[model samples]
Target: MSLRDAWDRFTASQAELEADDEQLEARRRGTQPVGRCHARSRATVSGVIRAVTFAPAAAGPALVAELYDGSGSLDLVWLGRLEIPGIEPGRRLVAEGMITSADFGRTHATMFNPEYRLLAPDSAEATP
Candidate 1:
């Protein structure tokens, strides 16, 4: 690699680095980009889980995970679920569900109770 390329790589922000990695992995897995998914359509997205949040509601508890696929991020909400095995931050997985906009005017994408499969750690990476 050129010196300039090396310097750019070294100086890239954590989010940028992660986005690049997630995008590459998504392509390798042949999954659709989260950014390209539209509302009311079914999509399968592959990405690394960035964050997990739990919120208690009157009906039941909700577990929400933020998945980033480099192009964009999607919030996966599992209503009435306290927790699920292998659903955590930094883990890679593929999730499929109907796309919906969390806000009016279609800003952010969210999927409720998506079917998901946790991917094994990459051969070059250590198990989280």
Candidate 2:
């Protein structure tokens, strides 16, 4: 399948998994790895990219992007070789991973081990 098709399928499957309480609990219990969450949870996010900052000097090419998903907002950071393409304000994305709280004295949480797939209105596949 094409990348776009694969991404779409992945998102759909992920959404279903997230809705499963048993699955969510299993994942939370660490019986299943976070990477298995899939792309649908990320795709289901109703948010827009509020910021994008690069930190290439650190461990990897990291980008701190703020996303407000109506219900709440969270800082999404991509580390290592994960490349966030065309990130900007008003751009919406679907991100899936493990949500962990941060101890920075702020009510902040992180979606670790995330797998994101950008949704474009025109539906063009992201070139690798």
Candidate 3:
């Protein structure tokens, strides 16, 4: 890539990190950290959406999403859900649910059908 392209990418990443930090702090103001989550205990986190995936299961479709804050990342599984409006990469969200280990040894904190709130896009987070 050209110098201009590389510069743009670098700046973008830094901006993203700052926004992620702010969102995480705001969301976790009175909640547990993702890295410190305890099994079977209720937990909450705020972060930027890293991914959204779709897969099929016996019951039906499943939506698996990952979010990353400054401290850590977590996986959110919505069984029988295909798509949730506003759940996409870079979007900030606050999620609450019981912390549980992955039955299949998968890594990271996880929650099933946790209550979530999509954060409104503010000027700072919306900027490139």
Candidate 4:
């Protein structure tokens, strides 16, 4: 890569990291820490989607997504939804709903059918 190309990549990565950090800070400022969430309690949390999976559920299909802030992570579950247009790994989003204590295998904490908002995209997240 040329010097300019290398510089561009470096700057892009830094921007992504900063944006991720900003999201984490914003989540901490207004919401309860995900790790401290209690069973059946209504919680508001925000973070970046680190992973996503569509699993077979008794009803049909379920979307299992992992949101990770700097402090912690939580699992967001949506039953009967095959896919959401904007939900994917690397997306920053906020979710609000009840935290279920119901056992979900390896899930840390789960929110079913929570209200969510997708944040603005950072180009760094889209870069290969």
Among these predicted structures, which one has the highest lDDT? 1
Q: Which runs in model 2 stand beyond 4 Å of their true positions? A: 1-44, 56-61, 81-83, 104-107, 121-128
Residue 19 miss distance in model 1 (angstroms): 1.1
Best by TM-score: 1
Model 3: per-residue lDDT, tens digit, 65-115?
897766667888898888988889888778899888766344766888989
The weakest ten consecutive residues by lDDT in model 1 span 119-128
Report per-prediction Cα RMSD to one decimal. Answer: 3.6, 12.5, 7.2, 8.0
Q: List the residue pairs that clash in candidate 1.
A: none
lDDT of 4 by residue, 2-121 (tens): 999677657777656665575556555586667778988998887779899999966689988988776567889888988888889988777899998758664477888999877778
| Whole-model lDDT, model 2 | 0.52
lDDT of each candidate versus the true structure? 0.86, 0.52, 0.75, 0.77
Model 1 Cα lDDT, one tens digit per residue, 76-128: 98999999988999888889999997763224799989998888776423234
In angstroms, the error of model 3 at 125 is 12
- lDDT assessment of candidate 1: 0.86
lDDT of 2 by residue, 82-107 (tens): 45556677675566665655643325
